[model samples]
Target: MSLAVTFAAIPYRRTGVVEMSDVGQVILCTLLLLAIAVAALVVLKRKGWLARWLGGSAILDQAPAIKRIAQTRLSRSTVVHLIEVTGRRMVVVESKSHIRMLPQDDMESHDPNL
Candidate 1:
């Protein structure tokens, strides 16, 4: 009996690793993008570009009717206020989720629990 052996051929090429210049380019691009975004934010905050875009003017056209008389802070973001509008006084409650207005006749500021 006779046995024959043969080796299969392999076609492959090894490539070089990434160069330092390529890494530097990537870092430079990232820094440039971050700088541009920071600059845009600074410009928006300082120049009030967004306010101008939303139709805000530097001058007041007329006086407001709602006047704040007094305020009591209930919590960090919650407040109760006494306000007068058009000679009618009322109580207003403000919170992160809701704003409430109570009728003038229903509110008693002298009450401690109020």
Candidate 2:
């Protein structure tokens, strides 16, 4: 047979172009896999199996080191908070752009004014 006839006799193969249906199927499968993984994590977390596997206490069980005792807003964008952290009480001033803490001496001086 001639080269043209031989080549023509071979089966036609489509190359390079991807169909929308094939893309949709791949996306669907990826979403299904992710959903299953998330569900498994949720179940394990509820059962505390993940904590045991990681060999430590779950982070949520520990008591917080910093606690907010009181807070007051000076204006719409500025706030003052009385907070306790690591057994030390302090005043924290927060604005939209900055945060600052008063010293212990300042706390003593300001205690009676509040």
Top candidate (TM-score):
2
Worst 10 residues of 1 by lDDT: 54-63
How many clashes (backbone N, Cα, C below 3 Å) per candidate? 0, 0
Q: What is the model-wide C-alpha lDDT for candidate 1?
A: 0.83
- Local distance difference test, each candidate: 0.83, 0.86
For model 2, residues 1-114, the per-residue Cα lDDT tens digits are 556643447767776476877998889999999999999999999998889788757665777889999999999999999999888888899999999999667867675856
**Per-residue lDDT for 3-87 in model 1, tens only?**
8877798856565476767988989999999999999988886887756666764533346788999999999999999999988
**Predicted candidate 2, C-alpha RMSD:** 6.7
TM-score of every model?
0.41, 0.54
Off by over 4 Å in 2: 1-37, 55-61, 111-114
The TM-score of predicted model 2 comes to: 0.54
lDDT score, candidate 2, position 15: 67
In angstroms, give how far residue 12 of model 1 lies from its true place. 9.0
